[model samples]
Every structure is written in structure tokens, then in C-alpha cells.
Target: MVCGPDVSTHTIAFNTSFCHLRDTSAEADSKLSTLIHEVTHFDDTFGSFDSIYYLRESRKAVGTERSKVKTNADSLAGYVVWGEVFYAS
Candidate 1:
């Protein structure tokens, strides 16, 4: 799964793997920030066998699913907010 420029609004699953901007050059800071954001979701869903099994067995847990989405959204929002603050200061 290749994430687009606006991955913040994208909904991605745990099983889905992505390699976005395969050719385009991205800044190190930008890439690291993106990776940090994406990895949080990956860790939450695939951190343990129980988590993996839960997703597989349920075909998607409602609460877990919602929580993951919220977490990612909040993280991105927070990143932007703090990044602005840091630059302004």
C-alpha cells in the first residue's frame, strides 16, 4: 500500500504494508516524522500476538479500530501543533 501525500486522512490496516513516495526524495526530518506517526499505529495493532489474533479473528474490532484511528489523528494533529510552536519560538 503506497500512502499518498495526504496520508493523515488515509485509513490503513495493520496487515497492509506501504512504501510511499518510492522515487521522490523526501527530507530526513519529514521522513522521520512520518515514520514516527505511522509506526505508532503499527505497534499498537501488531505489537503482540494477541492483538494480531484479535484483528484476524474479529476481522476488525470496533473499539480497537476506532481507538487506532483516533490515536493516529490526534498524533498528527499534535505533531503539527508542536512543530509550529517549535518553529515560532
Candidate 2:
């Protein structure tokens, strides 16, 4: 998915696979999480977070990646996803 740096433009394009899965009612949990991940990027201030943030939240599992968790916007969004999903239920 490609999210435009300018939120005011409100431009977001989901890849075919993400669209297919979301449209077909597949991977419900992951789809929601991924949606919020994209939203995080969109909500980011003036696209300031993009240059340094990693897109793959899964990378947090790696020991080297752990050090950057505090600065990782993706990981922060992911953690929010998990927390929101968990508490909302």
C-alpha cells in the first residue's frame, strides 16, 4: 500500500492483495491491524515520521530491531493495534 505523505490530500492506495483480502473478507484480524498501520502513517505529522520509520512491524522480533522500538512508529502503531484489539474485545 502506498500512502501519500500529505494527509490533506487524503491519498491512500492499497495493493491488489490487500484489497482482495479486505474485499473478500479474508484475514479479518490482520486486515484490521494493517489498516491501523496505514492510518498511523497517514496521521503522522506532516509526514515527518516516514524517513526514519520502518514499515515492517515484524522486524521488532529481531534483537537488533529491539533497540529502535522506541523510535519505530510502525512498532508503536502495531502495539496500539494489539492493545486496541485486545481491550475492545
Query: Who wins the TM-score comparison?
Result: 2
Total clashing pairs in model 1:
0
Candidate 1 segments exceeding 4 Å error: 1-29, 43-70, 73-89
lDDT of 2 by residue, 1-89 (tens): 54443476656676667654442122232456555555655554322243224334334333454545544445545556544322121
- Residue 31 error for model 1, in Å? 1.0
Question: Which candidate gets the maximum lDDT versus the true structure?
Answer: 2
lDDT, candidate 2, residue 64?
50
Candidate 1 C-alpha lDDT tens digits along 1-89: 32422334445443233344222112222333444444444444422112222112222333345444233432332234344321121
- Report lDDT per candidate: 0.33, 0.45
- The lowest-lDDT stretch of 10 consecutive residues in candidate 1 is 48-57
Q: What's the CA error at residue 76 for candidate 2, in Å? A: 2.4
